[model samples]
Target: MGTKIPISVLVVIHTPDLRVLLLERADHPGFWQSVTGSVDGADEPLAETCRREVLEETGIDSAAHVLTDWQLQNRYEIYPHWRHRYPEGVTHNVEHVFGLMVPDAVPVTLAPREHLAFAWLPWQEAAGRCFSWSNAEAIRSLPARAAAW
Candidate 1:
């Protein structure tokens, strides 16, 4: 595969009642977070990346939900283990944040290679469980975002 784009999307999938969905990484076992993936190509839109990752990772058709781009972006150093996926010397990534609101906690079909398991937890608990700081911050912001939605 070619080197991945440094741009990515972090999608917070949650219910109207503040229950957020968390996915366990197949590669990391216990490391859990929201649906996240790099853009498939340099020309792809971040929102499209968000939608695609949500479906590819959790089987959630985000097009059907209220997928709102929070207009938030976070740039962080790529973890050493995952840096190999990007171009040589590219050590950071810019992740656009989005929120996909479903009516309630819903069953999900995990993509076996990407995710090993899934859970819907209260927003507070979900935030606490996220492995990435950026992912957790997005979950922590869910309550206010949902309140305004």
Candidate 2:
């Protein structure tokens, strides 16, 4: 069997108005996060992985949105229960961060197998409620990053 790629991408989809989009995980009901997916193969670059994942998970075209590479990555152990998706002895993953800027907060179509629901909330509240620390951190960094541009 082929080895699982430890690298992945977490994309925060949001609007210029500070409204962040979140998707509830299908497997973990209340656990909400941004668009996320693993690199399917070793040849995919991280940036391409980011763009591809956002589209697959959210049905939003990355080219039509502002997809930014935050140049940040987080390495964390895979939760024991979810480790079956990886190869034996694989204990952690490296997640790259990205931000996809839509013009405004709007209804999104989620991949049913991956997510069950979607919500748009102001950045502050969105940051406060994300199930993942890395997701919250990315939301918290939005204002300053958006302002700088």
Best by TM-score: 1
For candidate 1, what is the TM-score?
Answer: 0.96
Angstrom error at residue 109, model 2: 1.0
The lDDT of each candidate is 0.89, 0.87
lDDT of 2: 0.87
Q: Please list the residue runs of candidate 2 whose C-alpha ends up more than 4 Å from where it truly belongs after superposition.
A: none
* RMSD in order of candidates: 1.3, 1.4
Per-residue lDDT for 1-149 in model 1, tens only? 23989998999998888999999999999999999998998888888988888888888898889898999999999888888788899988999998898988877999998888899999999999998999999999877776675
Deviating ranges (above 4 Å) for candidate 1? none
Instruction: Return the TM-score for each candidate structure.
Output: 0.96, 0.94
Most lDDT-accurate candidate: 1
lDDT of 1: 0.89
Superposed by TM-score, candidate 1 places the C-alpha of residue 30 at a distance from the truth, in angstroms, of 0.9
